[model samples]
Target: MTAGAAISRRALLAAGAAVGIGGTLMPARTGLARVPAAFEPTQRLTLSAGETELRLLGPDRPATRIYAYDGDQFRLVRVPRGTRLEARFENGLSEASTVHFHGIRMPNEYDGVPTLTQPVVQPGGSFTYRIPFDDPGTFFFHPHCDETGQAGRGLVGVLLVEDPRDPAFDTEHVLCLKDWRLDDRGGFLPMSEPDGAAKAGTFGATRTVNGRVHLDLTAPAGGDVRLRILNVDSTRVMDIGVEGAEAWLIAIDGHALPPVPMDTLPDGIWRMGPAQRIDVQVRMPMEGGPVTIGDYRASDVFTFATIAAAGRVRRPRRGGPLALPPPKLPLPDLKAAEFHSFTLQQATDAAVKDTGLPPEDPLAKALIDSLCVGGATYWSIAQQSWPTGEARHLPPPLARMEAGKSYRIEIKNETRYPHPVHLHGHAFAVLGSSKGRLPKHFADTVLTQPGEAVEIAFVAAPGDWVFHCHILEHMETGMMGWFRVV
Candidate 1:
């Protein structure tokens, strides 16, 4: 069957029986109603996006001109679970922009997808987003329009939803890992290169953590430290691991997992792609020592940050890392779920189909066109490239489903490079993979290996959700689609 084509009910049941994929067939529940109706804003804040100067190269070098939210390269917005947040975003740049709350399952209108959910916030204009912190985990927000140019220039921030039930650590730190494409004078290079976007994305020349060339901090000896690492880079994938400290992999993409020893994982490291997050608990040894965190995927191994065990011992090290509270999400009934499939591959002119779609506003189209990096379409999903510059209409959704219905989606990566497939407005369980075994966990983005097939199951949330590669270059070039849940 073709991608996005629905399987017959009888065939679906037969396949489920043959595979023994078991789950209780429960009545579909309206998941949208789970969001409280009388949520009042507990906190209000304003974020202004504009160009800022930062000495990215070094103190002796010229400051780089980059875009940032609230004049900071790494801004942290913490909202406690069960509370509501109202944030006003002011676009101070000369171009249009929108803020997408990555991994947050909120109302569709506030999703921040320009023209899809809300119009672009033009220059000097503002838009307010009312978000409910229902699920507590490590999430982020970034511009949905001109993603490659905007995000690569540093328009990204980390959003942490505090879960009161989560265990408190002696020291907690959040690291935002990103790369910069800068010249010797600290000026930005081209954000996207046609040849790079057509294949693997263009990698940045420099790497940093929390916008600093080197990050060093002190922690109490014999104490447990929680490190929340986020890969906010537009193109780079990192193999993150810690040295000189015993650490446990406690979470992935914000959601908690059974605490597993980092040493037990493959190669004692976890591969993190763009827009992915990982939470690790490190136990400092009694004696003073430096615990270094670095990206092992690099040729010489880049150490981005280090935590020294200095101050007096806070407490004796615990036996194991504490597990975080599981998020309350609707579980998918795989037995009765509808099946759909999508293939990620290279784009071709003949693959572009005219799906009946509504005409886009001329102004919005112009704004999007102006921000587009190039006129070439390089990647696609299910043989359909998302409409870009000069396209008169928006692309139709890859699939449409009834609200609250269970769905099992199989995404096959047919390209030469890995793609981190991200679905907005809902979190899905990684069922399994054809290449290897996967840990039991829930996430909004899954990094699929080239030529590998991965399956994910979730209960459809109400809204028009974007499904695309997390690699910003691939997404902008064409590897993007949407799903409509009515």
Candidate 2:
């Protein structure tokens, strides 16, 4: 009866049937303890690694301090600029954890999503976070509750939200790409949800950049670096490139893109997927050595990371040291659209083992034995079962959308797995893709894979909208859904 905050379930069975723990009444189990060490005045950053943990998505009680990196690496102790982060989350895993903050725009009650904004830190319990970095740039943090087994058991980290209009770098460097799933003697590979049904989840063949098996960097001789790339994986999709270094693309996924002198991307690589982020600017090579950037599309050469060249230089002043403030579109218009469509269905292996997070892979167990053989009964959209991350349906309230009107959404995937598709607050545009004519782009989130379908035009600004599928176990099982504007 410990873990507090979130209530209900009939008030925890009326306080456990007035204290008896008997029949006809149950529940009474909130968080299961640990997360009370507090400390939020900012400036106390330190997130060690090797075995991490931190939970606080729902049923909040005390859990924070995620630090687990088995591959590329993990460590983010930033808490200087504008502070206000309230700490206290430490999981050290054995299992059961939570702590997301990918793109921190806080307050949907913290937006961690595990039973939707709270509860489920289990294992070594502990959850207490109160972040508030006030919009900087190049953000990241992982483990949105069992996110394909704790982000493939490497958790994840790399959030540099300190944009004092950032522009004084002689070497900023932050690259957090991912992928891991080894056996035959590699190590670190403990994630589960092993098929039973989120359809497509577990993915890793061993790819790294920050936790390094490769991925090196060392520029000072000719100095001028700033390559903040992030692609915290859950699925897979990468092509990435850079060879003799002279790069210059500024940004994408995390905004700021106008320099475009980083040529050499003739689709030779750098194609990404799964929560992407990119930023570049390089020009170093005066007899320091290695310089390749990306590879491994089967066998192009196999590099992953490298950039040494530095003998004794500092000629950097090439492009004015600053100019990254031009991305704040906040779109919304298309004759007040409110249209909606999301259909990504395909569950079997006995409906992914009845949604318990693991079990199905013979083509999803022969399509769940041909749809339940004779037991039928599928019809799903809002019957709520998987994670109930919140927002099933709501728009008929006199057709909603009032506060500043302007909306348009049309997403359709219909199964095969490939949905980056996210939207909360505002940021939309890709008004071209019924599977065709899409070249003039602007995206907040749009992948749609499979049967593919897209059309997003935003401007409906009220609030309470979610629209999921950033993978995270397919929004924790049901693929999620939400809406509201008024």
Candidate 3:
């Protein structure tokens, strides 16, 4: 799928079977491929990544040449929750690229990363990914190489895993919110400037929902509906809320969480960072009206979609928010777990003293500064930089342990900006936060607020697992590190 393209799996119309790409909304970096390509894939598709001229600004403005997936701005891939996905991806772009299924806990080998999990699918060549979906939730896919450019140009898609027992709704909508950086002629601009990549990621100039402006939706009056919203923008964080109806929060980051009162949040708006997903249930008014889903985070508040009741009035489906079956995840035993800590900081900041590295370290502290992209290194974990390119250094394990052993990692972010941190192979329980105790839930990616600390616990799995910030450029430049569980 291309950047502006969309995909949807609308309730299967009856059951668990997912339909094709049509609707919805929906982030990675490098490591080595652990396995070799050997067999023909069970499902094969060709994805071409290149320039596509888009009339985004206006008809009189010059068409902008942006990247896309399979000629679409975004590709939609839908299947049942447990389907074994064996798809071969042929890279047609001029540069190196690999597909990372953001938020899906698949086997390490199939988790696309150049040199880290799998080698980049070179231009004109191909790579096959085979994995079965073990959890049902809202997820997305994009490049792990040159992500700031590849994804910025367009290459992003929606991957939906449907659960048969999920609550039924009269209709469903997938809203992928993103921003684009364009010139006056609607032409391209430099993806990332040094200052931007080092600080809050480069923000786009134009906002879009599912590749278009002013995308309007329709639902029956008083009908139950599900909204799967994703923030695929490289930098902009969103505070989303409904304007015309009361909405119930269903899930967070694809994990099933009990419905919480909207009042639990500020102004009842959900704050979604990069790569975060929120599922909400909204019932249209008994009388016809437009339920506007708007993003109020920016200076200029705007409506992405208006769910208008154009159809005949229908009786409400259920009396309350739909309940979902909680995932049977491998939760860690906190009492017996070994504890470790890492502080997130910027490379230039002198406010905090460095600690993790010993004087005898093989990768010198100054060498870490050499790996900076765009001429400056910006971020770090544990006071160490995970440099890219020839300086690509996978330093010693943050914590080495035996497989299946329980461990708790305290992740602290002292920077003034927030980062959506992602773990490669295993799902961990969000144990607690410095702000206060948080409800425990399993996730592969969790957001860390600035000046806050979060602790996550998990059973150690055997592998070289990489953990890093999900802000593409942030990872590419410095905020990436890994662990080894043998």
Candidate 4:
């Protein structure tokens, strides 16, 4: 069997055996039926990734494999714009795992970050998710807990909710961009630094364009195409561009941006923090040319993919995606926002190594020490771990937003590593950011570097909301927290 296939089989078997072991090992962490009341929705469903010889609770299992977060291809099934989707999911992980659909404004209960919005679905148990598909466009679903390990293992999917007003395109595509840190055998290497958490969380070696190694798309001999790309990486900030083709910018992170012609290319790498999306239009060449998409940096080792335009095609007028109604709420005001300064600091290995804990337990000091590939510990929000109720203790922002109140947030990063910060339940405008206060480009998750800061303004939608770093690993260790609106 191919290496990819082998990886899938191993993951399926590992998960299958894990469920059985969970009961005898982490008895308390088994059977999601006992998930906290706050996390349990009114309904639940049974779900698994691959369809093979796998049992979420037994020894025999299917061949399901998880890829490092990279781009993925998805079909946008047309669904009524305001439809509510009720899905029950079985997190195919041994310990705990949950999924989050980024950029789709859903009910707080449906937001899938574990510990903050809910608990990780136990190995064999199930949980129901209720999300109102109020808005539509390119979005993603990924594990929110233990992001370092689970996400790296390929636990992400696509949720393409179509807008009723969205005009038809010759073709619609969903691409999830990600990379993997692997050895020759294709197994993932853990991200654990001995001294600094930032060092532990950085770019990997190999990059994948659509959850796989290479992408070769077949376009009509001559036609206009739409490519919706999302950067779901845990740490790599990419600069994307297209070669041998003509293109245009249609949208950004599910929000429609004024049409911009793609002439020079975006430094050849799509650079946005995790959960960010961009929609571009590429028209097939008249003479069938090779359209390449991805980076060409000196540091890049290979080209992600090439679109060979060699078949009969159609010619269509060039225009932006159908106009989307502005979000129901208005943008938040920065001036009136409750300004808060946050810092991303690293934890010392000495302090983390010998917590005076035992060795056998995975949660014990020595066991966790052994797992410390780099001795990195994802930071915490206000010093509180996730799925905790610490947000209640802190002072609320001054705006005292109602269910529909708009507010602004200023996020500053004190360390050098970049972070993809995501907010639940609302689509906010990136007002601008700087060390003190400067206007930067508008973006959802600003990949701020050390000592860099950015400001985001958004109207708060009602529901329990979460805001945290998108560095999957950092989030898994601790860098996560929540916000609630009653």
Candidate 5:
């Protein structure tokens, strides 16, 4: 995890980039999934938001108007691990916007929460984000302001940090899993309804990866592949598994785990909630065939992508995995850790409203209160809604902590649906679980299964930080709050 061994994106995707055996012309492709494009980040990248053409309805009708960064369709964003991720974001949409590095622990000033970390980048304006990529794994970037509309209309992308020293695979495929809510002619339906937000949040009608209805991919025969998969869905939970090949679970939420074979798991699948990531490796048979990566969370399992085998068998045997690299993260003093518990779930009629606490500026409070009255307040955490509606409302911190202190929190989900819970600043060790003991890996976001509780511990960093549900609607409704570390 040392800094400064970074390779420029240009070198990584050079035309004659050397592979295990031969100089590759391009990354192998299969099915409807095309090969990953060159994400050449030359010091800085210029990303803008504007209406772009979408082919959700095929070639007959006009392209739909959907917001996007770089292009209407998103692809893999590759950068060296431990490099400074610098980008200038231009807002071309009709509203204010800011980009949130979904899982990166960037500086407090560039965290990108509108009115909380920095002022929103207004329409026609621009802002530059400088994030240091200390840890490598799967992550994403999307707008934080008006997320229900901003992200729901498509503005999402996957950022992959290249770990050169980590376990080497023949080649890897990057899958940005997402779902969309669109009508005939590829027009977007309503972002969300009050009823949908009040319940399971809003679910999209169409599922996709890299902006396509079905992803087609190709891999070399008799070789190992690393599947870098991300769930960018606004609300849907995906159960991911690979078919037609033997696989191993290598990482989760960007942190490398012990290489566990998929056959050891209950049903050879990993449950991924919104904003979560899972890396799996599969071996192509020596003879040759096609493999389909799938989502089985629904009653009828569906293929997320298809990878066909091509060419001659380069490597006859799929050997053992390379030595897993350790994440460069700080350690917490578990013996001296303080413990606290919090509950988040759907709001009931008898939900308790936190009252008689510290007050805020009257005008700001009034505006937020008015918005809450007009909009929805469908969820709650400890019986209170932070900001009530928009990020403008300044609510009191849910809890204040002394800087450098180790803390353990038991986050319990009382709702029926699982949440991809995210903490803003620091990564935590997932100490234990409701079902059994667990491997405590470092993660900014953790998937809490329905009606299950997980205990996580971390050291308190000095800053104002937030914790919320990654399901955008849940956060908009009420499943969001913040704590201050002094």
Candidate 6:
């Protein structure tokens, strides 16, 4: 038998044992019912987090010291859908770290939030994660502990779960959009400034696509090209658009949607914030030419990447991208869903408690400074600020619900800047927005504009799931909370 077929058989057997059926594992009443205690992993890999030098500014400039996974800036992890995979993470940095699988809906223990799901891996420590690839789509991973510092220095990687049933494309590319805060000498700058974090989180000075100043790729003329784009920036919002080609958006935040033409959207561009992703299919023109993908938010289009059509013309695929199979997720019963509301705004001094602890010694403070901790609190949710430093005692959950119950949450962004709110362990369906028409779709993160109220609903996933802003600086300070699901 072929190796691929052999692995497929093993995966089938594992799924059968997990669900007590000789077929694919299906969810029983709730999302967590099909989890297995132990199974042979279809794939296993090791990722080490450490500091490395990268010539991000230019080849002639000095290399900047950055943190990355497995010592690579553009590492991509691809696995087949419905398979069990194992990832062992080693922390080589001085501070603690944990890899959070950003948008996969799985068991709570593997969610990777420090102190909530699992303890942080200290320096030279290692942790293994057994993840079930039940849903297939575009996702990414990064350090959950001290994210502002680690991710800002380049600790990010893309994870793609390939679905065999999806239509094949002539060419495909993954683009990770990020920016770096650096000086002319290729030295690092402070990740978060107090004044900047207080309003809109601090932004990067240098922009890049996949850690390059300019990325050039090639494809055949008149072929369908799939572009999986992720905004891995800490605090930059992008209005992505395609130039010199006809493109359609087929997926958002790792979930497939009915393809929509780019021109039909607002101003022919899609607005994406931190931690958000979109899959677009572009049709290369019959004549050999360059197709540009850029951010159109500013007056001058900032072209970051380009794909050149070099080969002879091929017959173009008909129609938009084929719809991917729906994931095995419980549908929320809107009629019976419990309702809750939260306001995102600046925190008041009276609402925040000073963690009255003894000052750290110089030696200890230096270590903490290297990890970029001890930022001032500035934002809050529902008037409650997240406790930091000596106030490690977790506060009561913002809300609680029974497993298998449906809940609808209304998040109102009262602050001046936009907030990309992210919920862990569940993909909520965005119902609507008060300011603009939002396409109803399932996503783990949603960008809420200033003075906008966005509503989302989902069946509660059992765990202490964190709900917070995706902007790292804001989350680090005070704009974070959790929900309890029994």
Give the best candidate by TM-score: 1
lDDT of 5 at 155: 84
The C-alpha RMSD of each candidate to the native structure, in angstroms, is 11.4, 21.3, 9.0, 8.8, 12.1, 11.0
Per-residue CA lDDT of candidate 5, range 134-188, in tens?
A: 7888888887766777677788877888788886677788888888878876777
User: What is the C-alpha local distance difference test score of each model?
Assistant: 0.80, 0.52, 0.70, 0.53, 0.70, 0.79
lDDT of model 2 at position 71? 26
Off by over 4 Å in 4: 1-46, 49-78, 191-196, 200-202, 264-270, 296-298, 316-330, 333-402, 435-444
Task: Kindly indicate the candidate among 1 and 5 with the higher lDDT.
Answer: 1
Ordered list by lDDT, greatest first: 1, 6, 5, 3, 4, 2
lDDT of 1: 0.80
- Give me the displacement of residue 421 in model 4, in angstroms: 1.0
Worst ten-residue run, lDDT, model 6? 22-31
Q: Tally clashes: model 6.
A: 0
Candidate 2 C-alpha lDDT tens digits along 209-297? 66454756777756677888777766665666777766766666666655565454445455556776778777776654566777545
Tens-digit lDDT track of model 1 for 1-486: 001011123224333333432222111221122335676898999988898899888878899988899998877898888778888888777666778899988877778776567766666567887788788889999988778778888999899999989988888999999999899989778777778888878899888888787799878888888999999999988898999989998988888888888888778998878999999999887875699999999688999999997775645854667888776888999999999999998988787665644455222332332333234678899988776545534577799888999999999999999899999989899998898746778999999988899999999987778899988878877788888888
Sorting all predicted structures by TM-score, with the top scorer first, yields 1, 6, 5, 3, 4, 2
Write the residue-wise lDDT of candidate 4 on 43-146 in tens digits. 33334532222111113422223432222222123345566566666544444456666777765655664433454455565566666666666677765544
Give me candidate 1's TM-score against the actual structure: 0.89
Off by over 4 Å in 1: 1-39, 358-374
lDDT comparison, 2 vs 3, better candidate? 3
Clashes of each: 0, 40, 24, 38, 8, 0
Q: What is the lDDT of residue 117 in candidate 2?
A: 37
Off by over 4 Å in 5: 1-42, 60-62, 348-350, 355-374, 389-392, 437-439
